[model samples]
Structures are given as C-alpha cells and as structure tokens.
Target chain A: MSAFNESFRFGIRNIRKRPYRSFCLVLAAVIGSYALFVGLALKASLNNGIGRMQERMGADLMIVPESSEIEARNILLTGEPEFFYMDVAVATAAAEIEGVECATSQFYFTSLSSDCCSTRVQLIAFDPDTDFVIGPWIDERVTSDVSNGSVIIGSEVTPLSNGKVKFYGNEYSVAGKLGETATGLDHSVFMSRDTMHGILNDAKDKGYQFLNPEDDGAWVSTVLLRVSDDADITAVEKEIYNRAGGIRFIETDKLISDVAVKLGSVENIINVTLTVLLVFSFLTMILFFSVIFHERKKEFAVLRILGTSSRRICFFSLTEGITIGAAGGIIGLVLGILTVFPFNHYIENSLDVPYLMPSVAAVILYGMIGVLVTTLFGSLSSFLSTLSLAHAETYYTMRTGE
Target chain B: MAFLEAQKLVKEYNRRGKTFRAVDDIDFTIEPGDFVMIEGESGSGKTTFLNLLTGLTDPTSGAVIIDGRSLKETGDKEISKIRNQKIKYIPQGESLLSALTVRENILFPFTIGGLERPSEERLLEVSDKLGITDLLDEYPSDLSGGEMRRATIARAVINKPSLIIADEPTGSLDSANTFKVMEIFRDIASEGTAVIVVTHQKETLGYATRVLEMDQGSLKEVV
Candidate 1:
C-alpha cells in the first residue's frame, strides 16, 4: 500500500476506535452544513422571487379608483382578484400629463365559481393597440397575436385537452402559458379587450349581474403609467394627483422597496444564524482535535520512531477529519432537501413573501460546495494540533505518556 | 570497523542557570554479534545514552556513528530510514498501539514507509521465535505483560535490523519472564545482530557478552 492509502486506512481505524469522539465531530459538521444549505436556499428563493416581481411590474406607477389603493396593491403583489372601475377618460388624461411617457388601461373581471367556468380565476383584459406592460410579455410567449378568440393562461392555469379554456360557457383557444412570476398573476388569465367583452356578454347571458346602472364599455379598472426616465418621480406623482380628481396613484418602486425591506430583514436573520452555526462548529472541531492530539501523543511518537515522517503523521490525522466532515456534510444536505422541498409552499406562505426554489443543477452545485468547504475546514482544524505533535521529540513524548 | 561507535558523547540539561551533563564524555563501541548490557542506577543517564545512540536526541557535544556514518551529519529522513531498516528500538513501556492487533503492530514499520512487507511466512517465523504466534491477532490490551513484551520485540526485529536497542526490557517482568526475554536477546545476538540492553537488574548481566555500568554520567566495563 502507498503511504497515503495506509494513512487513510489508519485514520479510519482510529475513527472507529473512538466512536463517540468521531460522532461528536460529525454532529458539529452536520449542524453547520445544514444551516448553510437551508439558509442559502431560502436566500436564493427570496432574491429570485423579488427579481421576478420587479420584472413583472414594468410600469412605474399604477392609477386605481379612489379608495381602492390597498386592494390594487394586493392584486399586483399577491395576484388576488379584485375589480373596481373608473371612467376610461382617466387613461387619456394620464397620458396627456407632462413627464408621463406612456399610459395604458386594464380591466379586471373575476370569474364565477360555477360549472360555467373551468376554474375560478382572475381575468385581466389589456388593449392590444395601446398596451405597454403586458404586450412585451405576450409577444415573447405567443408566436401569433392574442386575437379576439384566444386567451393566454398563467403558469398555474390548466387548459382543457383540446388546447382551449372555458369561461362563462364560452370556449377560447389557449395561445400560450406565461411562466411563473411567484405572484397572483400565476393564477390569472390574460386576453385582448375584445375577448374580455365576449366573456362578459357570455356571463350576462348566464344570468350574471356584473353591469352597473351607468355601465358602458367606457370604464377601465386601473391605468398603468410609465414616467419618462429623466422626469422626477415625485414631480410626476404630484402632477398626476393634481390632474386626476378621483384616482389613487401607486408607485411601483415603492411596492418593490417595501418587499425589499422585508427581504433584507430575512437575509439578516439567515446570515446571522449561519455565522453563529459556523463559528460554533469551528470551535467544536478545534477543541475535539486538541483532545485527540493529547490522547494520541504517544501513538504519534511511536509512529515517528517507526520511520513515519512528520508530514505523513499530520496527513493521517487530517484524513480522519476530512472523512468525518464529508460524511456529515452529505447527511446534512440530504436532511436539508427533505426539510426544504417538502414544505416549500408552506415556508413561502408562512414567511408571507415571494419565494422561488432554485433549479436542480444549482442545488447539486451548492451541495458539492458545502461538502468541500466542510472538509477543508475540518482538516484545517486538525492540522493546527497535528503540526505541533508531529515535530515533538519522540523520546520525550513517549516518556511523558508513560 | 566497529558496528556502532559513541565518541565522547555528552548530553546536558539547563535548570535554573545550572548545567548538568546526563551522558558525560562517554566513549563506547560495539562490534557485530555483541550482546551488551548497560546497568545503571535511576539517575545514571543510561536511557539518555541509548537515546543518543538511536538518534532520538542530539548530544550537546560528540557524536554517534553507525556503520561509519555519523548520526549528527545525517538528516531526519535518512536517520529515520536507518532506524527503520538498520536499527530497532524497543522502548521501556507497553508501546503497542491499542487500536491494532499484535500482527499489525509488528507490520507497522513497513507500512509507514510504504515498503514491501515481509511475507506471512516471515511474520509467522518471528512470532514463533518470540513464542507469540498464538497472540498475533490479539490487541495489546488483551495480552499479558510478558506476551506484550515479546510482541514488541517481534515488532522490532520484523525488518531484521542489524542492531537492536532495548531500554529496560524487563523492568516490570517476573524473574522467569525476564530470563526468557534476556535469553531471546542472547539468541538474537548469536545470529550476528548487535544487541544493547539497558536496565537496573544485575541478574541480566549473566546473559551479556559485555556488561557496562553507568554512574554519574560515566560508563566503565564490568566484564
């Protein structure tokens, strides 16, 4: 056998000889690795979720009906279905305001939970000619235009086998499905204004009373506005409020900033917990190796007298540490997968924040990094103790042991 | 040429600014097949002299030359190889690793340097010579004192070194076991290997071809 192989075998034998000590070291590594894996996964999920939200809210500001500001925020942030309307003239007025680069109107309609629909979901209608927010998203997903007879479904929406979706007894061809945005939009359906009016007429024929006394097609639920890049956002908000009489403005940046603050708090907690766990595990390894060296001083002295080089002795000790670390790291990552993946939705809901798990390849990469880092640190801790013992006078060490 | 030579060796210790010599100007030599015994009182520095001979410690002045090469001039790796291949040291206590079987302990010297191990037949032969063939698979904790000593001797001689340096080999053994151990050393020396044994027992002198006594860091031949 090569010296390295013999050292590895000897290390394994030593670990087996002191089962309790090895167990303690392994436990320390496990706790540290588990914390690292779970913390990284949670942080990555939140960051990804926030990034998607920022991309989805392309509009700088949202103009909703008076007194429905909170409801509009809920719809945009969480994808909850809510409907309120203002005169469609507000879209024209907002577009005419100075510093307003683009303005578009959207109509919200919540479908009924009756047999007339496949599932109760939110229906969002955007004008294909004057749309800026949803137009680019639709263009990317659907090869053909979103015509009056077709609808684009969200990632969570299931279409019938015939590649069609039904709402209020009217069937529309499914053009495409949007990818996940980790928001209520994932459960919503998007369509052109003409298809939306057809759904409304079908709903009316099915005895639904969605029309108000003053109802006309000239009403829109919310007006999305994009301010010019060089324009001051506060000045534009003031100009919109001064120009519009019965509309509440929601700054998209403010919404994202609020979520960012919450994400920051969560990241802080995770980082602190990870730091504490790593420090505790590192200290435990150092202490464990110190005790092991003290107990094995004579053994090392004997090896030295038997023609084992000092470097070889240190390598033997380091091998034991690396073995314990790798074993613990793998076990910890397995436990992390079991804990995080099974309760993914629960964790997101409990945290009341957007969360998106990373891809399979990313998870595997992180696991490998965790094992490598743990093994490195484990060997480093053992090296500190082994270095001194290896260089000690063999006769003095043996005599002291006796 | 002498198989081993100690030339005016001196080892000193400094305590509270006072210098004490453990082995003072000790000149010694041993030829091949010499069964030598060194007897000394508790503080007479016999173990210190053995340490110098084995290159375990450097002498403050003078040198030990083995087979014409000075120990002081050799580097650690070369000295360690010499210790492994040419000389064997059996320390004064129970030195077997508790984690390994007696056979593994005997084979450890070869494994440590990645050297090709002796054949199983050779191992059995050594065990048979030491009367420890039945205890090859047993750990150090399970062996009696005499059995452990014999196992240690087997480990020492497994490489068939040219010289053996044993310190207090029978310090804790009974009269019968001590005689058995000394007779084994005598038989080993008769086969052309040099043997040096340091002890406080006068009974061991009968088995030595040359007996030396140490007092106050000086050695004198008694026979």
Candidate 2:
C-alpha cells in the first residue's frame, strides 16, 4: 500500500477504537458547519430577492409626488394598496430631461375597496405605448398583446379561473402569468392604461368618487425613468432634483440602501452568531485533539521507536482529524441543502420579507468551501496537538507505556 | 569496526532540583551474529541503556554508532531513516498497539518505513515461527502476556534489521515461554543479525554468546 493509504488506515483504526470521542468531535463540526450553511443560504436568498426586485424595477429614477414618495415606495415593496397620485404631465416633463432615456407612467388602483369587486387585489396599470419596464417582460411571457379588456397577472396572483380575474364587477381575460420575482410585483396585477380607465369609470358609475377617471385633475401614481448609457446617473439625479416641480426623484439605488439600513441590525446579528459558532467549533476541535494526543502519547512514542518519523506520526493524526471533520461537513451540507433550501418559502413567509434562493451551482460551491474550511481547521488542530511530539523524547513516552 | 557501538554513553534525570545519573559512561560494542544479554535489578537502568543504544533517547554525553554512522551526527530524518533501515527496538512491557490486530502489529514496521507489507507467505512464516499463526487476526488485548512478547519479537525481526535492541523481552513471561523467546532470539542472531536483550531472568542467559550484569548505572561482564 501507498504511504498515504497506510497512514489513513491507521488513522481510521484509531478513530474506530474511540468511537465516542470521535463522534463528539464530529458532532461539534456538524453543528458549526450547519449553522454557517443556514446563515449563508439565508443571506444569499435575501440578496437574490433584492436583485430580482432591482431587475424588475428597471428604472434609474422614479418620480412621484413629493408628499407620497415614501408611500409610493411602500406600495411597490408591499402590495398594500393606497391612494397616491401625481399629475400625468410629470411623465412628459421627465422625458424632456437631458439624460433621461425613456419615461413611463404607472397607475396604482385597488379593486378591493369596492364591495362589487370579487377579489381584494392591488391593480397596477401601465401605458403600453410608453412603458419600457414591465412591457418587454410581459411580451416575453405571452405571445399576444394585452388588448382592451384583458389583463396579465403576477406569479403570486391567483384568479378564480384560468383565463379571467374579477375587477369592479367586470371580468378581464388573463393574458398570461409572470414568473416568480419574489417581490411585491408577484402580488400585483398588470394591465394597460385603457383597462385601468375602464375600471375607474366603472367604479365611478358605482358612486366611488374618490377615484373618478374623468375628474378635473387626472393623476398617475409614479413616473419610472431610464437613464442613457452615456449619462451620469448621479448628475441626472441632481439635475432632476433641481428641476423638480412639486415632484421628487427617488433613485432605484436608494431603495436598496434603505432596506439594508433598515435590516442592518439583523444582518449584524447573523454574522456575529456565525463567527462565534465557527470559532467555537475550531476551539472545540483543538481541545478534543489535545486530550486525544495526550492520551495517545505512548502509542505515538511506540511508533517513533518502531522507526516511524515524527512527521509521519503527525500526518497520521491529522489524517484522522480531517477524515472525521470532512464527514461531518458533508452531513451538515447535505442537511442544510435538503432542509433549508426547499423550505425557503416558509422562511420568506415568516420573515415577511423578500427572499430568493441562489442557483444550485452556487449552493454547491458554498458547500465545498464549507467542507474545505472545516477540514483545514481540523488539520490545524491536529498540527497543534502534535507540536510537543515533534520535539519530544521517545524514551519518556515509552517508559510510561500501558 | 563493530556492527553497533555505544561510546561513553550517559543519561541523567533531574527531579526536584537533584540530578540523577541513569546510564553512566557506558561503553559497549556488538558484532554481527552476536547474541548479547544484560541482566539488572529493578531501577538499575538496563532499559535506559537499551533506549540509548537504540537512539530512542539521546545520550547526555556520548553517541551510538551504527554501520559507520554516528547517531549524534545525523539530523532527525537521517536518523529516522537509519533506524528504519537498520535497527529494531522492543521496549519494556506489553508494547503492542491495542488498536491493531496481531497481524497489523507485526506489519507495522513496514508501514512506518513506507515499505510494502510482507506477502502472505512471509507473514505466515514469521507468525508460525513465533507460534502466533492461530492468533494473527486477534487484537493484542486478547493475547496472553507471553504471546504479546512473542508478537513484539516477531515484529522486530519481520523487517530483518541489522540490529535488535529488546528491553526485557521476557521479563514477565513464564519459564516455558521465556525459553521459547530466548531460543527465537538465538535463531535470529544466528541469521547474521546482532541481538541485545535486557532482562533479569538468569535462566535465559544461556542462549547468549555474551552476558553482562548491571548495577547502580554500571555494567560488568559475566564469566
């Protein structure tokens, strides 16, 4: 047999001899690694959810009424319907800005306030001619355009029938359902401006004067603007703020920064807990191996007398440690992957926050790294335990033999 | 030149601020095919002298030379290589690794030296010679004291090293097994390997070509 094979066999045999001790060490590693995996997966899923939100937003700057900027963002983050509107003329004015590529207007309307509406759902309306964000996405999901009386639903929007959703006593045919973005958009319904106008007119006929379409000052909730590739977004933002006439420009980057700031304490808690767990596992391994090495001093001394090099003896111990640690790591990773990933929806629901899991490949890579680090720590512990043996006198150990 | 030589060897221990000499200026030599035995009372430093000769412990004042190489002149790797290739040591008591089977214990020298383990025929030959062929698959815990001693001796000779230093190879064995172990060492020495055994049993000294008695860290030849 090869030298490595021989040493590995000896290491395995030693571990088998003390199954309880080995089990405790491995259990410590598993707990540490499992904690790390869960933390990383949660972090990755949250980041992925944020990424999808940013992608779906597809706007460099959003213009809303200066008084309702916070409420507009709240409406986009949570599907909680609220009455917030700015002049529809803001879309045309924002389109005239120097660095603005395209400006699209969105209308937020709730069908749930009307007792005549069948389902309590937040309704979003976009102009097919001017919309650049949700329009292209809808096109990718469906072959036909959203015609006069039809609608497209978000992935989370559940209609009573396959082809129609009830809105203000009118049934609109469902064009298609969007893929899950794990964002507020998943809970909102999308239609053209004409359809939104029809819904409002129908609500007006039913005596809801709060949202009449033909009223003197008609309004759109928000104006989504894209910046040109050659233009500096910060400069455009500054200029838009300067030219803002009773409206505010909220940059897309600010939304993410806001969420991070809001959840910073939770993130810090997770990170600190993970760091403590990792350190505890490492120290536990060191202590365990220290005791084991002290107990096995006579065995190692015999090996030294039997013509084994001190280096080889150290290697043998390290091999045993790494084997146990690696086994624990694998079990931990498999448990995390099987338990934490598939149950991500439950975590999302409990936290009531955005969460999207990373791809399988990314998770596997993280698992590999986790196992490698665990094994490395195990090897480090082994090295530390054998330091005395490296310079010890074999006769002393042999004299104290069992 | 002697096949193995110990020149002015000394070992000292410090306990509670007092220095005690364990092996005091011991000088010894053994040629090939020599079966040398040393007898000493308890705490007379026979094991200490054996440890020094095997390079398992460093001498405080002198060196052990094996095959023209001084143990003091070589680095750890070179010394370990030399020991693996040329010397075998059986320390006092039941030195068998409790975790390993009797067969694994005998093949340990080969594993440590990075040499291929002995083939089945060679292993069977060694095991049969030690009268442990029936117990090859058993752990050391299951073996009798005499059987463990014989197994340790089997491991020592399995590599066919040029020198074997055994400290009390039969100190705890019964007369029958003690005689059996001495005869095996004699046969090993006759095969052209030098053997040095440290023990207090006078009956087993008959198998030795030379016998020495140790007392109070000193050695005198026996007539």
Clashing pairs in 1: A79-A184
Name the best candidate (by TM-score): 1
The digit string of per-residue lDDT tens for model 2 on A258-277 reads 76664465567778988999
Per-residue lDDT of candidate 1, residues B67-93 (tens digit): 999999998888888888888999888
Candidate 2: Cα lDDT at A25 = 86
Candidate 1 chain B — worst ten consecutive residues by lDDT sum?
B152-161
**How many steric clashes does model 2 contain?**
0
Off by over 4 Å in 2: A58-75, A78-105, A109-122, A136-143, A148-150, A153-182, A194-254, A350-353, B119-122, B129-131, B144-146
Q: Against the unseen true structure, what C-alpha lDDT does each candidate score?
A: 0.85, 0.81
Every candidate's DockQ is 0.64, 0.55
- Candidate 2: clashing pairs of residues: none
